[model samples]
Target: MPDLFHPQMMGYLESLVPQRHEVMLEMEARAREIGFPIIGIAGGQFLYQIARMMKATRIFELGSGYGYSTAWFARAVRENGGGVVHHVVWDEKLSSQAKDYLGRLGYSDIVQFHVAEAVETLKATEERFDLIFNDIDKVGYPASIPVIKERLRPGGVLLVDNMFLHGSIFDPANTSEAVQAIRTTTKLLTQDPQFISSLIPIRDGIMLSYYVP
Candidate 1:
């Protein structure tokens, strides 16, 4: 929650790109107006770049809200002729909103909506992903680690948002379930021999993990 970058730099970042769907733009405006972070444009842009660099053919997202980030990932995956994006949202209202928003963005075909818990939904789907993004319930992040690891295809990438939880992961006394989950997942990625992990200092901090084959 602290200012990782200066206001001038943030403004500079926002000025670099301007193309987005009308609905995506409106939803972003609403998030801004309501003082919600909801994946800043800079953050979305960065995520798109990551997906591109990884040459992601298929992607999965946990806790997609309003489809802003989903649209970015969709665009990145589209270059591969076409790809599937599964968005697991726990709230029906938010999931419906995201579905309608994505429909407006002309991405309903590439995106699928599942209004259910992420872990449970993952159990039923046999789909493997080239890239996975997790921004699910913070309290359940640790529990989802095994599930996420199980779902990631070999050599696939796992990108986790809100790793710092506003810098709470470092505090031993921080009692939030989400913070603890972040810490636990970070520890796994850090010590795992088959993966390379980095804590990216972009917007609330994102963790990028690459599986080694």
Candidate 2:
């Protein structure tokens, strides 16, 4: 997938990023080997920064592939003394792999990994979170807005990945469901009085929506 920044710009930004943990390095290698779509260093670092800034105690991740992004949040929560991250994935095998990865990162105790439909899992829980990270299937983005808004605590954060979807959202002619859903969701976020939203043009782009209640 094409990155949002130019090659040189991305390289320069990447150079400024601090070195990662050995486990993170290994995870990156694994993702590369599996051709997985991880948020990578830029996005992961940003997530950590946001979580730390908010002093986030409880977080919920809509779609956790192998716990890469979850690792970043988990680490942030640990540094803040204590917290829990609820991660949902549809595949049991993937959930198991995610557990192993979090275990390697020593975040297994801090993260709750669930293998189930993302929306259903959220609906079943009575938890309110300090942060909601949405990286689910793009076609379902719009559907998650009201649900997440309801569950997010006042002044909490909502971070949505793949907002650019390989730059598909910019092409007005593309009427694909994924593109339309994301566009509509973005519009809703921007138009909603409760959310202060902005598009972070980072890796694949991410939408940062802050809930004001």
Give the candidate number with the greatest lDDT.
Answer: 2
| TM-score for candidate 2 | 0.95
- Candidate 2: stretches off by over 4 Å: 1-4
Off by over 4 Å in 1: 1-7
Q: Which run of 10 residues does model 1 get worst, by summed lDDT?
A: 3-12
What are the per-residue Cα lDDT tens digits for candidate 1 across 60-133?
89888867789889888887678788888878888888888888777888998999887788767787788889
Give the clashing pairs for model 1.
none
In terms of TM-score, which candidate is strongest?
Answer: 2
lDDT of 2 by residue, 1-213 (tens): 986457687567667779988888888899889899999788999999999999998999999998899999999999988889998999998899888888988998899988899977887789899999999999899998889988999999999999989988889899999999988998999999999999998788889999996
Q: Clash pairs of candidate 2?
A: none
| lDDT, model 1, position 123 | 63
